[model samples]
Target: MPWDLRDGEPVIDPAQVRALLREQHPDLAHMPLGEPVRGWDNTMVRLGERLALRLPRHAQAETLLDREAAWLPRLASQLAGLPSGTPHHAIPAIPTPVRTGVPRTGYPFRWAVVPWVEGTPAVHVPLEVRDAYAPNLAATLRGLHQPAPEDAPASAFRGIGLADIEDRFARRWDALAGGLGRERRDQLAEVWRRAVNAAPYAGPRVWLHGDPHPNNTVLAGVGPGPMASSPVLVDFGDLCAGDPASDLGSALLHFSPYGREAFMAAYDAGQVPDPALWARAQGWAVNYALIFAAQSPGEALRPLGRGLLA
Candidate 1:
């Protein structure tokens, strides 16, 4: 199959990735091995050994892949729960492995090879197992904030400002909140504005996952043992270290009130961003959901951005 649907959206062509693997890794010689391990961004496959071939999924991720290529090597000494570092900075631009023999050079968009992690998808794991990971992830964030070796990219910290977040937030609010009563929108905007204008996240910034939602975490389950939430926080593509609140939005930024509660329950004593800053997070989410919402025809889903209006 060339593509698979996720949350009702078509992800990408698996054949595209397979072709990419074949073109780059002639050594494989079309060996019949297994299926394409799936995720939102890249096509992943586990090799025979404890290694895996992770291929980048898009041109945008190239920016992220570039960051990973540079950052992972530095963090490897410090990080304990991730797969190996990304082999190259950009896909197609660099020749790297896809599966065993699949190389990523001479391809269309960005791609790379990363050691496959040993873990199960977090959604498959029980909440009890997932909860155990909160602290480790918190520590992981704490660690990422540690200074890099000085040469990391500018995005290493979330350079986005509260004003930047708010400007985007206002634009999205104008677009989606237009349907709601003006008084309501203005009131919420005022609350969101004050929340943004007043909160304090003054500590020096540090590198962050940009997002740490469940989709990115891997929980391992060995034999009959309970699931292990030894979080493998991959997808360093969005890694930035601005106000820590930019990352906090990933928790409640995308959820409905009820959903946000359930999602937030996972983070015990985690940092909470200001609602206004979160409004900015919503701004980012609005851009995200709009891309897909515009892709086919689901105007309704765009309002989903208003989930941040609170």
Candidate 2:
């Protein structure tokens, strides 16, 4: 497990989940429930070969789970409308829930049965291999960054101005200053300053993945040739609508310098380049880097945070 349950949060076991499925979704009760994999907000257990059950581990994740259940299907439909044989078509799949479960006497949050996407987490894949898929990643973002509806879900921590969360950033920075040392902290401060000073986004709010870090992406074989191992975006817990720069900043987490160039070239092909947007994107990268380092300490993403800062 990569995360711990917060104090007072209940622990859900296989027996309880199985009982819930038997009561609410009998058809799925017979399937084997694999070991649970705990993420920041949810716990996932593989249900047989083709499906997985996603349940919130705590009350705070309940709303996020609801939002994903509401929006992923709609996003999938929009992506499906794209012409075949294009880069958009190359995006293998989104983890749309096939079935949903409601809160019960013991289980207090909603759960969903989503298609089990087969692939390797992008974090485990070498940067060179990830570089090969940068164009596909770019195209996926282009298709996904459509203007969102007026009532779409919004995020306080993402897709908003960096200044809005400046206080939060400062707290995390200061807390980690001793461990990160003066040199690293000073470098990160400069990135944050530039991001806050950059021109605010004047464009419409766009659909954002909200948290598109490498771990949230999966590299699955989609088609033949170079496009075989396409990147599949997953974990819609933080899905929301806000500045496109919020998602664009993830390019720093997903690519090497050469790969980033390829991604930008592919992403900015037709539209006029926005220097402010790119600066803000870098700022978002800084934000995520700090988050990863602060939240996980000496874990896998710590090195990644250092890379992003570099």
Candidate 3:
């Protein structure tokens, strides 16, 4: 039986996914399906060994996968086709959909099957000593921020002008103030103002990962040093074209004190950031910190919000 979406929560299971696959893609339906991994937008399940299925769990989340499916393949191909002499960073493998699924049976949302990537979510691992991963992260961002096509999807919040979202930022900060303590709150306010006042990005729009938090970045084998590991970025639902600062801000949200510095150093080695860009990035970081902190105190992301300021 098709599971219902009760109380706005999507009910999905391995059996439902397998049934859907059998109806639409019968050839591989017999293969074992993995347990569901619930996320903010979709429920992911491993298909066989090398593939994974992603089904939308919310109405808004349904709109993003098509965009991801359409653009990511081209982007991945372009990066792979780069000439040997072209200045590009070592971009970790990005998951690209091999097949796009249509609405069938009781499942109403569009879905996709993509190659599975191997790694542990960065949030579950210790971040304090993974300073070495910062440069790699920076390089990945530098490569991703290349100018996107004119027809690329426009984001209401992701890549738009920072000044446009000032009101939203204020509300989030207001909710976060008391929990953050006076000193930290005051420090955060200053950071926000500096970012809002900084000169805006005047360059052509570039593609962005939209959300680059620790949970989105996956870490592979441990390196020689303690807490060191290879990093792989996942989730392109928030992918859009915009200011590089939007993604840079995530470094603040994900990395520790020294790791943040190392990320900037590595990024600067490839493309030096202007003072204004740095300021704007800091502002973006503040925005994320406030929002995460403002969530219900018991929310899991509250710690991440605290760490952004720390």
Query: Candidate 1's residue-wise lDDT over 1-310, tens digit each?
Result: 2124434332434455457656765554354434665555666665444444565555554556666666565555444433344221111111123333222434444555565566775545545555555545544444555443445555622545665555555565556666657786676666555555655555565556776555566655553244443566656667655665556555343344544454444333345634544555443444343232333233323333333342
Per residue, candidate 2 scores C-alpha lDDT tens digits across 148-197 of 87988999888999889888878877776567767876887887788889
With a 3 Å backbone cut-off (N, CA, C), the pairs that clash in candidate 2 are none
**Candidate achieving higher TM-score, 1 or 2:** 2
**Global fold similarity of model 3 (TM-score):** 0.92
**Cα deviation of 228, candidate 2, in Å:** 7.4
* CA lDDT scores, all candidates in order: 0.50, 0.81, 0.78
Error of 3 at 246 (Å): 0.7
Candidate with the greatest TM-score versus the true structure? 3
The CA lDDT at 195 in model 2 is 88
- Summing lDDT over every window of 10 consecutive residues in candidate 2, give the lowest-scoring window: 220-229
Better of 2 and 3 by lDDT: 2
Q: How does each model score on TM-score?
A: 0.60, 0.88, 0.92
Segments of candidate 1 deviating more than 4 angstroms: 1-33, 37-40, 78-106, 118-120, 123-133, 156-159, 178-191, 199-201, 222-228, 252-310
lDDT of 3 at 190: 89
